[model samples]
Target: MAIARPVRALGLAAIMMWCFFLWTIFRPGAGIKGPGDSLANLERDPNLDPTGEPEGHLVHTSDAYLPDANPSARINATLLALVRNEELEGMLQSMRDLERTWNHKFNYPWTFFNDVPFTEEFKRKTQAVTKAKCNYELIPKEHWEVPSWINDDLYKESVKILEEHDIQYADKISYHQMCRWNSGLFYKHPALQNTQYYWRVEPKVHFFCDVDYDVFRYMHDNNKTYGFTINLYDAPYSVPSLWPETIKFLAQHSEYLHDNNARDWVTDKLRRPSHNDQASGYSTCHFWSNFEIGDMTFWRSQAYEDYFNHLDRAGGFFYERWGDAPVHSIALGLFEDSSRIHWFRDIGYQHIPFFNCPNSPKCHGCTTGRFTDGEAWLNMEDCRPNWFKYVGMG
Candidate 1:
């Protein structure tokens, strides 16, 4: 009886130890409760299913994974679009393509701006296309209107000359306003006040690849200031005075230039002999701004503001068809580090008349090697080679 009592006690102890071991392994938040195991951490983990569902099970929820929930996990960015009410169909098409390619997974908010109020139909259709929140904002009049400092007669004469030369949108005042606003004023909008990064989406553009990762987070983590897919030479005739004006600005604010600037990519200084004075001229190479993923703080800086004011006061936006593409490119090439400006070669993008298709497994419905033609002239005009050489990636 004594031996049996001792055996029974030993058996009870063994059972209790076994139960403790099971609790350590299978209790709620047991082995997983360590670094990066908090509820917030699990919610922010892109690889994990936050709903706690079984693997391969789909869970539908109306609530988006708001970046505000865990600010450290995501970037303060938005997909920004400047559109008019009349172009609702084109906007919807762009929304559909982007959603299908990328945004559907991320659910980043869409912020739309217009000089006028967005129509109910425009709002409804755009919101219907995505589960993300949609914000509609009217561009303030002061931001869109022609500055009073501009000479009316001089502007009119310049437009007539550009029209005579068959320049695109030369006679349209609205185009001029758009160019000016996009160049300097877009970042000033109250709607974008809270946003640090923006991916500019234009109407009727194409997104041809599955962007499985978070682009905004990539930009933030990689220290990238500006990202672009297409690079092209700007029309030299359109901005006759832009280069000269940029030279003057550089001379005045030489301190603003970054030590490792990409100025050589935009000029022939490195290509020509050191003694050549004419090599300092602008190459007219620029990033196509129709599709831009940029850090807004770069535009909001005092240096950029001063540069924009200098150009704005020069009246080139109206007197000449000075595009925002060149303006933005020039600023980034001079002020930001070359390494910080990223060429998004993995993304397959297309704006009308051109394609930035990449030879990537993620891309679909596009032919690779379509970025440039075989003609030597076309290839020389392409800024990609120069950019590649500048970045030492070619």
Candidate 2:
């Protein structure tokens, strides 16, 4: 009887243990909740489906994982790059950084332009790396070729003199073509017509900050016409005739010059154009154009189109090796209010020796540090210290 009683107790204990095990495995509040229950219990997003299912998928709503608005519809913009087949690798590096920093979340489209057709390998490799929509187009030969208006005899003479003086890219005809295309022709490209805004990127450029917000949206909302990262003096030797021509244009078309402009930064105390040397003429301070975000409407406007055409007719792009930086600066100086031009101090950019690094720790992952007091270039006569002063950004 005693043995039987002990056996009975043992059996009851076993039963209780089994029941607990089953409860732990299958009960309503069991070991781990199912996906549906877990999702249902989560804090709901204001945008979440009231029925707790979004498009037949489990809704995993939480403060940490809130529903995200699609950035594409909000941004009327695209990333533009002018690259060659050989520049594919360098461009990919820049693209990868761009994705990591900003574009991955937004999935903005990218348009790559080349004077010649892109190679199959270049296309395949670039598309494989990014999920964003990628388009490649060949620039028309007419757009890239030297215009008939340019005097071939004079251009040859200028190139000879520049080459003798060892000026950078002076001997390369392609460089001049590139400068001219960027200065006036790129906005007219058929592929870019639909976009209201563009962010121009060059090969091997670095994106240092994690840009969480939409830059395009910001521009749209703020009514900003132009954005730039670095401001420096254009090589005076490269654009000696550019400012004088600009002054002449402004004088004749007084209506084009904005009443509120940044001309003081680009011009001298005499209210005359100057160079970095503080000469009686231009200070040559211009926004570096390699990294620019701008409203396309600004470029398509008559003011800019006329300005570019006037400059083109002058033959300085071919003769004096004029660059797009000074050309763009001159246009903005004349057409837009100084207040509309934005300095992207948060962005970190580097092109060889010069860098526009932000002081913000928000860019901790950047490869380079901030431009410091020790930088000799910052104090150089060519750097736009006065622009910094005028803009109250130094």
Candidate 3:
């Protein structure tokens, strides 16, 4: 009787082991699904490619314009550029490079904004480059001009001080107007009312890599609020009161700050020497505004509007020459989660002296390692380390 009982126990244990092995092989995420698997199972599988492309498919430069490479769904987006009528040639060069590298296949529409009416020649020449629809809109006078509340005497004195310090564009009132307009009024324009996402394109900038995927769709599906290609320090002399005014706003409305906010990156609190030392306000690190891909809804939100109004009331835009770069950076750093702010490391972009040349196979007409190995000025202003450290990737 004892021997027969032991034999039955051994058989039962073997059967149980075999069942567990089968379960492991056929688990939900094991990549071994039957032909009869449900679509829900396929959607839930993380091992599958998000782009729906077959595994191991190679993407060449010519593949950028392939009809089959287009995304299955597209996000509501546009290529937005605020340009002058005189920059026609430079704008054309930028448009061609972007269309060649990425936009030809998807054919997203372009929206151009000018403080004044666009010239017929400028409109015709730009429209001739691509298959996408083109829009030209004039900036409203109220949106482009200095606010009524700005004290003229204070503003003039500030400009004089900036000039004495040899700050760039200090004596130009139009530059201040442009910075203020870009910071608070661009998204409010009538032309961009229906658009949810915008990729800002500036004249004379270059796109170096072949982008095989839809960036707007990527931003939407991935829940990214802001994307940038370059990071650098802002000129401190240009924004003397920006950080202080930002602090005052934060104090008044503490609830607006995100729980996973990148305050440390902007404040440089983590790298401070001691607790007793005064906290370093805004390390002057900012994302260069020239190459920005962002969701317009964030800028249109109440938090951002209130923040902008506070800064505008403080009169830094005209009083101290506050660039749009630092204003946007400070807002994102305080109000949004750091993870939602993306760095497009694969995109190769250049705006004159600065370059973001990623070491990728898809790039053309640019060399890698220029940010680190090529220029002394770029190295001094590089803010990637601070950003990387904040994100726990350094």
> What are the RMSD figures for all models against the true structure?
18.7, 23.8, 11.8
lDDT of 2 at 293: 93
Instruction: Write one digit per residue (lDDT tens) for candidate 3, span 135-242.
Output: 999999999988999999988898899998687998798899999988999999988888899999999999998887778877877788999878887767777678
- In angstroms, how far off is 379's CA in candidate 1? 2.8
lDDT (tens digit, per residue) of candidate 2 on 138-246: 9998899999999988989999877775669987899999999999899899888788999998888888766666677667777779888777766567876787888
- Model 1 per-residue lDDT tens digits across residues 1-394: 2669889999999999999999888865443312332223322112111111112222232234543344333457899999999999998888999999888777888999999989899989999999888999999999999999999999999998777767798878899999999999998988788889999999999888777667787777678799988778766667768878999999999999998887766773332223123223777778999999999989999889999999999999999899999999999989988878877766778887766775656777865443233344233445665565555321
Judging by lDDT against the true structure, name the best candidate: 3
Q: Each prediction's TM-score against the native?
A: 0.78, 0.77, 0.79
Give me the overall lDDT of model 2. Answer: 0.72
Determine the C-alpha RMSD for candidate 2 after optimal superposition of all C-alphas.
23.8
Show how many residue pairs clash in every candidate, following the order shown.
Answer: 0, 8, 0
Better of 2 and 3 by TM-score: 3
lDDT of 2 at 58: 22
In candidate 3, which residue pairs clash? none
Q: How far does residue 264 in candidate 3 sit from its true spot (Å)? A: 0.7
Off by over 4 Å in 2: 1-72, 269-280, 365-370, 374-378, 381-384
State the displacement of the C-alpha of residue 192, model 2, in Å, after optimal TM-score superposition. 1.0
